[model samples]
Target: MRQGLTWFNIASLLLGFLFLYLPIALLIIYSFNESRLVTVWAGFSTKWYAEMLQNQGLLNAGWVTLKVAFTSSCFATVLGTMAGLIMSRFGSFHGRTLFSGMIYAPLVMPEVITGLSLLLMFVAVALDRGFVTVTLAHITFSMCYVAVVVQSRLAGFDRSIEEAAMDLGCPPGRTFFQITLPIIAPAVVAGWLLSFTLSLDDLVIASFTTGPGATTLPMKIYSQVRLGVTPEINAVCTILVGLVATGVLTASLITRRQEMRREAEERQAIANS
Candidate 1:
């Protein structure tokens, strides 16, 4: 019975992974096809990737996407961290429930509704639908995700260290910067990465908010896809997969290293004491 259950679990895990990654794997494989037709694989070639580089529209869109993702993610991280700190550290402040609800409302909100509402708000304010609008819209939604991540991390955090710092005459701001921030740095970074990914992957909100000269990679790819999927599109998608995979891997390695270093420091401190 035990042996049968082990085999069943292994098969289920393999199937789960196959279901999740098979399309991506196929897309990557087709990216190198010499044929312009994405589905009909011809001889393998790197021409699509080279051609992609030369496509000025794609290049410009990619640059815009990167800029938006980076900018929105940074702002989201800062604002989200502050919100998370307040929600987790402060107990029952005035309108805490309302504040928390507002922070998380975006998470459950429909993307179409959010996009429509933002578009109306921008129009109401006479804001142009362009790069700034898209970035602001992204920050508005992405910050909620960041807040959730940071708040989860802070939920079980040890407050004794912070209390001790305050007892020793450290100002609240100083204690946060010198002690609490370091301990929660991983969570903060994770939140930033999450926000970055969300902003990068977003399409509907970006489309509604963006205007001339600010087309993101997703919008570009989507437009191209509507015309037809080609090997070049496959190549672009493969590149995105590679970039995102590299980022996640790098972050994981850095987080693991930090964890190991923190563990070592804790052991050393205990030994010294």
Candidate 2:
């Protein structure tokens, strides 16, 4: 019975993976098709990739997307890290519950509502709906995700080390930069990566906040998809998929290495003591 159950689990796992990744796999495969029609595979070719590179519109949109994602992720990481530190380390403060709720409200809020609110605020302030607007909108939503990730990491953090540093001559700011930051660096990095991914994948908020000459890759792809799905579109999507996959893999490897090094350092410290 146990053996039968194990086989069933394996089968279920395989099926789940297939269900999740099969469409992506098919898209990647078709990206190499020579035919312009995405569904009809004529012969293997890299022509679409070449065309994607030469297509100025797609290239410009991609550049814009990268800029927005990078900028928003950096800002989100900083703000989110600060918010996480406050919520986890400060214990109780006046209006802490209200503050926490505001920080996390975006997580459960509908994208449409968030986007609409941002749009109205921008309009009210007479802020142009361009790259700046989109970046701000992304930062607003993505920061919440970053905060959640950082807060989870900080929840079980050992405060003794920080207390010890404070007990010593280390000032709070210095200790955070020299000691606390290094220890929680992995979580911060993970949060930044998550924010980057969210910004890159976001379409709704971007659509509401963006204006002329500020088209993102998603908006471009969506517009093209409405007209038709071409081999060029497939190639572009494959490239995005590849970039995101590479980023995730690199982050995982870096996080793992940091963890191993930390473990080794702790072991050495214990041995010395």
Candidate 3:
């Protein structure tokens, strides 16, 4: 039996959405404000955006952030995918519990601790805190998220397909690349996206690990916010929000299309069988 939403449920949901989005709505609206004061709207203009474009520091920070995000997410995806495969497909192994726990620890660990620990580790290793350090730190933490996502997908995956492929003389590496990877590609892509977003949004760890001249967007925004909020900051934030939203929506649509195509092919196969 289907349970229809009641008035209370609808009201609660509306309140929740309003709580979440009202601030974002206000920020988007204020991004266009001509006044320097964020709350005091003098007029609407796109000068803030123009100003953002002209600000070389902000632009450089954005570029650095993109570089870190892309590099870290790619590395994280590769490492996390391997971890997920081992945890899901390799069965029990030595120190499995400890390994799994370590992988998940980052998810619940406080950022301050994680950042401080990474900073200390970098210092001890004599690694100059810079783009490489920041990227490494991001990969370390972000990989955990990817591992969890890929593991969840693997948990529900049908192993019979792989088994049948193996029975038909498909080598392990060949079967994984040809069959397993394709089926789980969506999840891997999602994991990469999740890692990318995390890397882009991270501030604390970056602050700890980054050296001079490697300022990321979040660090730049935080520095400016310490002084005061401005229409320019709002403009930057709005742009980031738009970018993240577009990326997420595009990924979702692609995943959905792939899933639908796979389902249709499966249905056709069933009919033929």
Candidate 4:
């Protein structure tokens, strides 16, 4: 029975990994495939990547996407860090629960509904559907992701440090800028990157809100894929995957270094005493 269970677990692990990886593997493989019919192997070639380089529309869309991502991430990080700080520091209040729900509501709410609602709100307010409007929509959802990341980081932080800074006659703003922000900087930065990635990847909401000449890379990819899938799209996907992997590796390394430094300092103090 134990042997049977072990086999079952091994099978499950393989199955789960395959399920998670097969599509991505296929996408990466397809990018190198020379055939226009993406499924059939027509010999490997780097022509599609070259094609991506030559396609001006795709390049323009990518630029737009980058702009939106950067702007949204910057605003989201600032707004979300503030929100997380407030939600944590203020603790319970008359409408704290409601505020918390509102902040997190986006994560659970249907994307289609959120998209439609934002579209309607824009229309109702007579806001023109353009790059600015799309950025606003992106920032709305991006900020929610930032809030989630910052909030989790805040959970692990001890409040005593800020109090100590204040007790030392530091101004409130000085305490935050000097102590709290540094402690929370990693989380804030991670949140910003997350927001940027989400903004770049978003299609459905962007589709609803984006106007003429405001095409994002995802929108361009989706439009092209609807007509026909190509290695160019696959190349773009591979690039995104590579970028995300790089970001994750960098963050992990930084966090590990910080942890090791803390441990070393603690050990040194212990040995000295």
lDDT of each: 0.89, 0.90, 0.90, 0.86
Measured against the true structure, the TM-scores of the candidates, in listed sequence, are 0.89, 0.90, 0.90, 0.89
lDDT (10s digit) by residue, model 1, range 97-143: 99999998999999999999999999999999999999999999989
Ranked candidates, highest lDDT first: 3, 2, 1, 4
| Backbone clash count for every predicted candidate, in the order shown | 0, 0, 0, 0
Pick the winner on TM-score between candidates 2 and 4. Answer: 2
Candidate 2: regions farther than 4 A off: 1-7, 252-273
Between prediction 1 and prediction 4, the one with superior lDDT is 1
| Cα-based RMSD of candidate 3 | 2.6
Cα displacement (angstroms), candidate 3, residue 27, comes to 0.9
lDDT of 3 at 252: 69
**lDDT (0-100) at residue 212 of candidate 2?**
90
lDDT of 4 by residue, 1-273 (tens): 665578779899999999999999999999999897888999989999999999999999989988988998899999999989888788897999898998999888888988899999999999989899899999998898788777876776767888998998999999999999998787888788778778877899999999988999889988998988878899988887776676656656655665565567668768998
Query: Tens digits of per-residue lDDT for model 2 on 1-273?
Result: 665678779899999999999999999999999888888879999998999999999999999999999999999999999999999988899999999999999999999999999999999999999999999999998898778767876775667898999999899899999988888888889888878888888899999999998999999999999998999999999988887877677667766776676678668878998
Between candidates 2 and 4, the one scoring higher on lDDT is 2
